[model samples]
Target: MDALDASVPAISPSRPFRASVVTFRALVGSGFRRYATYRQATVAGTFTNIVFGFLRCYVLLAVAAGTAGAMAGGYDARQLATFVWVGQGLLNVVGIWGWADLSERIRTGDIVADLVRPVSPVTAYLAADLGRGAHALLTRVAPPVLVGALFFPMATPSRWQTVPLFAASVLLAVVGSFGCRYLVNATAYWLADARGPLAFWTLGSGVLAGLYFPLRLLPDWLAVTLWVATPLPGLLQTPLDVLIERDPPALQAGLVALQAVWAVIMLALAGWVQRRAERKLVVQGG
Candidate 1:
């Protein structure tokens, strides 16, 4: 499994997790070293994001210019710039694309190998994903932000709590994202392939998560609906909003709270879904 399997579970004894703390640490290190070998691809992706960042920033600034009082969707010019640039930085950190390992394994029946392992596939994959997110933050998130800062005015957090809050939000985002992706990939266990679901996921996730544009640009009712009802917004929008201090301090904390809730829900659902699939397979054995 190429680390993106999101299918590998850590382990559990009486709970959803079973892997020892030391084994989980080794798995995380293995995941980190696995992706670190892709040096050139990381550079290429960074360059692509930078190019898109320029285009996105200019277009958003134009929209802001035409808005009443230059408040483009509850954001000032500086915040919009920060939103674009920092968003570009976080794009990979939350990993919105290029994860098919789990589905591919299921389709090939290699998941049978995973099933017999000592650890739970879900927890194992989550630890690996954390390693991947850490690598992304170290290598993929900086260049575009630096490039954006050189060319545009990016918002800096005015609150002392913003930095810590933003960090917490990001950790939740990665955890939530892994669960969401795992669910999408797990569809292969039933559907023979995950392409159909993955297509729908790829189609909606970026837009709904506020990657191409802020959800706030939508009508308040719709934006709030997405925020409260779906996990999409928490993946990217919550952290970016926290980092830019878009909401008041209390509201900022509230958003992170929401992210935490969604992360827990997604993980619970993933564990449930995987258990269901396993139960079916075992019952069919004659």
Candidate 2:
């Protein structure tokens, strides 16, 4: 009896943790391998980024010249050029594509399997998304950084002291951006038509996140409103400010704090919605 009992399966409470770790590793590995196979797309993307970087620089220079402005948002013409170049390069690293959502899963009933997994849905999704970002960083960010460096004098921290702070800020920006997207995706739990909401969020993110232009150049009231209400400015604009070494300590700290707060709030909201979604899951059509 003792020998037979020793052969029986053992169920541990930590099974979920072990499963999550394995899932994360497999997801990241597959993402890396998949990205490596897309060599042509990566090369083309790098060239396209370089062209756009130069074009944006030319446009900004023209604007500065016409206005006879010393700077807008604490950037000279050359500095602004560098900012645009870096921003475009980092765009892919930041997962500009909004792909994480349970809509497709729900539509196809694929989420049925996900629901059975030992890992939390949000954590599983985050692991997969981080894997994708890792691939993009290597394939997309690196080449553009090289090309932009050759063409423009990109901004660097004035002192080594800022490097740690900059790194911390970028990390927080990643969390903030991911959190906002996760919240947007979670809305599919309630609305049958989430496409419109997703589109609206994307457009709003572009404007408020300062992806198209520096937030500082925006109208004062509009900028203030966005900074307070959305996570956009913290993601791209704050990183740019850190890179340019122009932002005051107080402002940078405030932005980082805002990013942390948003990340926590969005993550909490996503968890709540996900739990509610489990009970609401309905198979409507084949």
Candidate 3:
């Protein structure tokens, strides 16, 4: 037989899409299993949460004592307590460490393999993040919430209406935070050294995002400017506000709008960087 007749035909199917689904499923399953195995880490996280919550509560109580019962930034003792509780609890679920290893993947050429996957790179990355978030919420987030409930009675949402609103706000916060991190991580494609950039961005964003403290305590103009220019408020501050404060509809709507705007901008930037990186890979064999 001729060579062509003797040889079996290659069986190649669409792999990128299938590969992406496999990657997502593997990440989710691994995250669930890893979470089960990390009991010590989970306990340590709980202890840390308790310690920080105690310290924050103490500081707030001391400040309140000096303020002579006057409310600060629309939060009284009870509301402030609730704020700390919610903030600390949500931190775990928020996955605020930023895009896990996206920068490293890009810099080390692993992104080349990722780019060949049939799924959208963005979607795949987000699936991994969601897995982490799920793990944290089940372990870390629960401890803070339980501790808060035992130690302090928070203001429960008065109406059922608030539940959906809070849920929506939290969803937007997650998306906004993910987009911001993705944007920052994508800079690795262009920058020779991205650690410094990542550090600077993380610190600035952390401060503005209310990961450490509430932005309501900042000067009005400064808070407004940061909220408008950055994705920080949408990620932490806005969600916290919705969870604790009874913000007017105008403010709530404004925050949501800002989140949408930032999501669009960051997504556009990430897409542009990713396309450029893909071209570079084609030329340089990354």
Number of the top-ranking candidate, with lDDT as the measure: 1
Q: Pick out the ten consecutive residues of candidate 2 with the lowest summed lDDT.
A: 4-13
CA-lDDT, candidates in order: 0.89, 0.71, 0.71
Per-residue lDDT over 1-286 for candidate 1, one digit per residue giving the tens place of the 0 to 100 score: 5778454554556553344875687677777777799999999999999999999999999999998899888999999999998899898988877788888988877788878888899988888888888899999889999999999988888899999999999999999999999999999878868999999999899999999899999999999899899999999999999998889999999989999999999999999999999887532112
Assess every candidate by TM-score. Answer: 0.91, 0.83, 0.81
Model 1 has an lDDT value of 0.89
Model 1 RMSD, rounded to 1 decimal:
5.2
Candidate 2 local accuracy as lDDT?
0.71
Backbone clash tally for model 2?
1
Tell me, what's the RMSD of every candidate? 5.2, 5.5, 7.1
Any idea how many clashes model 1 has?
Answer: 14
The digit string of per-residue lDDT tens for model 3 on 215-252 reads 87788899899889777887777877876655776677
> Which run of 10 residues does model 3 get worst, by summed lDDT?
4-13
**Which regions of candidate 3 deviate over 4 angstroms?**
1-37, 282-286
TM-score comparison, 1 vs 3, better candidate: 1
Q: For residues 214-269, write the lDDT of model 2, one tens digit per residue.
A: 88887789888877887788778877777777667777677777777876776777
| Residue 202's lDDT in candidate 2 | 78
Ranking by TM-score: 1, 2, 3
